[model samples]
Target: MLIGQYFQEKILSSVKCTDKGSAYAKFEWLFGKGLVTSNGQLWKDDRKLLGPSFKLQKLTGFLPYFNKHSKTLVEILTKFQHQATNVYPQLVRATMDFISESAFVQDSTYQINDEDNFLAATHMALTSFRLRLAKPWLAITPKIWDLFGLGKQDKICSQFVNQAMSEAIEKRKIALAQEQKSSSETGENHANQKAFIDVLLDSKSEKEIIGHIMTIFGAAFETTASAMNYTLFLLALNPSAQEKVHFELDSIFGGDKNRDVTLNDLSGMKYLEMCIKEALRVCPPVPVMVRKAQEDIPLDNGQIVPKGCRVVILIREILRDQEHYPDPEVFNPDRFLPDECAARHPFAYIPFAAGQRNCLGMKYALMQMKTCLAHILRRFHVSTSQKRDDISLINGMVMEPKPKLEIVLTPK
Candidate 1:
């Protein structure tokens, strides 16, 4: 599409993007208003202040949260041991609970599927949102289906979610204001749960915090759950790979359930890490990253992608590059062993993305995914349903293998 001779080159990485009205504009759209959405100094400032939260060491405190949520998730899945069912939903609920606890610590209602708490409005708004939502939400993505006229229904959905967030933000502002005043009068050091909401409330504006909480909630719950779901799927596909992970767990922890996995233990999970890397190579959570050419950047091929262009970094294509990855289609975990993997360009396999816009949830998400996998694998022998191949392959803002991810879980 960008004048490359072949499809692979065009999608892989041949040209830098610049069009505003192109698919490559999705990332720019999502982060457009906030630091994540921008490229200049605003992005720099936000990244500088918030980036340290993701550093490996600063995140150790969240391990207990991950472990606890993982145990709860495993308990839920164990209840369905005999039935052939999709595991992704279970994981979604679990990860959502974890992220919700870590973000909107004061709001119990944000956790979906709670019997007494339901966001019928949210579900209603988002369901027909793409097709029926208004122009602003639709326009949020610079590149999308504009062939059809913009619908009022779509706009309403957009308004609804925003309205919901606005209400929550207002309430949080009042609550925080009261807490601050109360603390000042009593001279009592207030307690906070350190969730994203708490993090933002400390230094940022209420409205900005609202925007960030929405973005973080979306990223934290969905991407991590997707990663965990795919990990389970890949392990189900490769039993030997799962066994190797089990072997590592056994060697490292000696089947002792009391010994919780720590950061050091994660480093010891070399093969399991490779398996995760290889799975990501095959099916990244965000398969393609979209970027806009805010300014023209020249490439090695002497092509200058002019400003205002939209670019699609087809990470799938790059990860499967025959030139970079020999036997590109195979799910070979050993391909990621330090000696084998260090030979390639780090940019070639970008599941989490590259440069400053990289995922802030990377460390937290990885911890959640890895710990859940370790716990589940340690406790049960897992296998896919007979109909796994027949599962619907649905593509959304994220790609998912639908329905029949049904796995047979037996007590180990």
Candidate 2:
């Protein structure tokens, strides 16, 4: 069986799925009825409530915040030129700060340049839990090697992340409570005072807010980081594209000054935008998405995916299909120059996935990515440390470049 299909079949086993149970009855509570893990009325309601955030108007409000954090990224990467530091890690930190600052009104934080590396530990713990959650049968046929105890490993990492996230939530709650109290007395509260979290808190219960934050991070951080990483990798490999990106930036905003590029300026950087889109097409951060059939659904192939059947959508495959993209393997930005991308199915290029379960923070994620790339290309030139023969991809919940992508940065 193919890697994707094998995983699906394992999720569709008979014991847990015996018709009465939902296709995704397990882990349903953890992920909740937001995107990526919900079904029926709850799923649709969550989708509708979150829809307003992705609209163009809402995204425009995030620019000032994006500009603030993208500058932090530039300062951090400014160090990469003299030292062969892993620039990817810096990008990860940059995106984290961007989200933490922008996602809530109360938490306007800057990078202490923590480089906490909490995420790495958290990833290990979560992956272990996910492995166990995905493959419960392992407990049935236990081996001593397995007893090397991922349990303890999980608890340690989980403790670190849980502490950090819990602290953030607690701080946010206290700040909001204070803000609300002040608003009541002064009666001078501004409408813009509410952030993304406030809107969710208003519309949904507190428990739902917790789930939304968890889902947002799970979908947001790694994807934006990967996008930034691939972008640098591509720029490093193809100096011409890198130069073109800078030229586009210069043409719109000029080469000498450091001014906040507006939506109009952002729109003018068409070529650079195309380059980002192509990079996403070739190496989408979330290359595939898995869903469980809510109920029996029929496919065009005359086969029925029963109620409990697990469905894996191979977004990468669909993107690279030669029939859809005539020269599928080529990394040409011109392919996304409106005429071409507009011709393809929206679902065909599923970078963020699609439908009711599409990524909720899609607008915010794109805003962060575009701002970072636009700012960086204008400031520094990116290139790989050594020539690479092939650009192979790493598979995980979010696909990342394998074998540490090292790039050189010189003043542009």
Candidate 3:
């Protein structure tokens, strides 16, 4: 197990020393051979091909979808006002809707309808994927497991997700063709604002497109939702911090809660961004990351990692280390204040990991999260009876609150 900044920089920054660990192969069954599961040339090519879609400028185009779905989330939570509600599922659906509209150009009215088989199937599929990773026998005997009906649900869920995403890709292709034809006839140029799916459709095959879509969907929704939930839970337990966030939001919006969050507003949300960063520090969405050493890599501490050895970076522990963060258990947003952050070691706080293979959607996730929180906090006062010590996290692909993250939303 590796902890602290030096190892992070050495291992993650070295191109030849680490690709992805072998464990990520298990993700291929569910996420396909997308950017998350691919390594070497394939990973590089996919990253380059899809890179333009997530640029800061491109992300501004996604704000409308974020605001639209965040409004739907607030509306849905109105029914549970003053009642302690499990907001995780609602958050999951809201983020699912965000990714669907922004990335796939599909209208996923998950929040309004409250019934999404695709979302449920995705949950099941993730659970099954985790199970396979835990049990080596399950990974080896896929045919036998299916023959004995042991993997029926897993198979069904996987098939359903693939088919659904495949169909969405096809639908977008037809729509794009029609749009292009119309633009050609009228001499109108609509090329500046292409969705993520539109960019993929231009270069990738159907199978490859499905892979990338699933990769982004799988990476984006649940993890972003988890991060939002954790931040809210932390805020609920820490009213002062929550009030600070409210104050920032009020100052930014100037008592007008209904207006859309402009790019300038997002940039100006310094305090709220601090709370989000602190929440990420306290409870990162993904608790651990594994990287396999490709060659004999030497560490600063006079230790050598032999070739083909798997190294686990203890993100949760590293974030809480006293070397970097003092009184790390305390919920203090000031830890991320500009001067303090400048004083700290760069790799000491890598919730999104570090290096070339760092999360591609980091910027996109932050934008969506900030927009959602700005909307939620502006309209409601969040509180919870649960204390930080009482919370137990189940560490999986994402670190989730074990029982559920329950909070009471009292409208301001």
Q: Each prediction's Cα lDDT score? A: 0.63, 0.66, 0.85
Write the candidate numbers in order of decreasing lDDT.
3, 2, 1
Model 1 lDDT per residue over 1-412, tens place:
2332133233334334312244323433222345444455555676676676566665666667667777776777778897666787677677766765555444343223554222443343335432322233555532443534434444554465566566666676777788779889999864523345555666777556655665665556666777777777778778898889889988888887546778788778888778888888877776666666666767667766667766656666677878777887677898888888789766776788765466777777777777778888888877775443565645455666755466778777
Model 3, residue 177: what's the lDDT? 88
TM-score pick, better of 2 and 3 = 3
Q: Estimate TM-scores for all models.
A: 0.78, 0.81, 0.95
Pairs that clash in candidate 2:
236-383
Candidate 3 local lDDT, 1-412, one digit each (tens): 5645558888888776546777888778777788888877878888888888888888888899999999998888889999999899899889989999998666779877745667777878777767775665867767866765757887788778878878888889888889889999999986556889898776888778877888888888888999899899999998898888888899989988778888999999998889888999999988988888778888888998888888888889889989888898998999999999999988898898888788888999999999999989888999988887787987787887767878999999
Question: Native-vs-model 2 lDDT?
Answer: 0.66
Superposition TM-score, candidate 3 onto the true structure: 0.95
Q: How many clashes does each candidate structure show, in the order listed?
A: 14, 1, 0
Q: Candidate 3: lDDT of 75?
A: 87
Error of 3 at 210 (Å): 0.9
Residue ranges of candidate 3 with Cα displaced over 4 Å: 1-3, 133-137, 185-188
Question: Which 10 consecutive residues of model 1 have the lowest summed lDDT?
Answer: 1-10
By how many angstroms RMSD does model 2 differ from the true structure? 5.3
